[model samples]
Target: MTLVRDIREDDAQDWRRLWAGYNDFYEASVPTEVTEYTWRRLLDPTSSLIGRIAEIDARVVGFSVSVLHDSSWTSSPICYLEDLFVDPSLRSGGVGRALIQDLVDLGRARGWSRLYWHTQANNQRARRLYDAFVEADDFVRYRLTL
Candidate 1:
């Protein structure tokens, strides 16, 4: 059985391992400083970031990180699922689905206005999982890096 739960202080090492795998899969080379900062933010109570981990028989196998923020379009907060990854070996084993379902349950309980996320157009594997929840909107995303 897969168990999903909020991230804890002791999960740093396991989280880092999964995090590294996540970055590797995306071919992203996030700097060490930024990675450390993100870990700290996830553990900070006052931060808007929320982190959850998935464990199968006590071994961490996946994780999801989301951000909560007030939205101008709605009276309630919105949840943006920033990062989600399952161990490559454990893909298709229900961990990914469980993590997203956990977020959906959390959003419903918290009265979030919406929950959304995005991925590269070529990420068919992830798109398949995401599409199971909702159809993709016809929205284009642009970024400006300073």
Candidate 2:
């Protein structure tokens, strides 16, 4: 069975491996400095970023990061799934699904109004899995780099 739990200090190497795979899947590259900063933030209790790693037989094979944010539309908070990654070899083995379910449970426990995420339109496989939960939003996303 796959076990899911909060990311621990000793899992840095495995986290980096999965993080590299995640970046490769999106064809994006993050600087080592930025990655180190993020790693530190995730482990910091004061940081808003919360991460969970999935382990199968004590080896980390997947991870997810989520953040809780205040929403004007509701008095309670909403949970945004910032990043989720499962080793390519472990895809379709319920690791991703379990991570997502864990996030949902967390949101429910915290009284979050919504749990949402976005994926590239070209990611048909992920879309297929996501579709089983909720339909895509009609709005488009735009980013402005500072």
Model 2: residue 40 alpha-carbon error in angstroms: 0.8
- Model 2 global lDDT (CA atoms, 0 to 1): 0.92
* lDDT tens digits by residue: candidate 1, 84-137: 999999998899999999999999998998999999999998889989999999
TM-score, structure 2 vs. true: 0.96
- Pick out the ten consecutive residues of candidate 2 with the lowest summed lDDT: 101-110
Candidate 1 contains a number of clashing pairs equal to 0
lDDT, each prediction = 0.96, 0.92
Alpha carbon deviation, residue 45, candidate 2 (Å)? 1.4
Q: Write the per-residue lDDT of candidate 2 for residues 5-98, one digit (tens) a residue.
A: 9999999999999999999999999999999999998899888888899999998999998887888999998888999999999899899888
RMSD of each: 0.7, 0.9
Residue-pair clashes per prediction, in order, are 0, 0
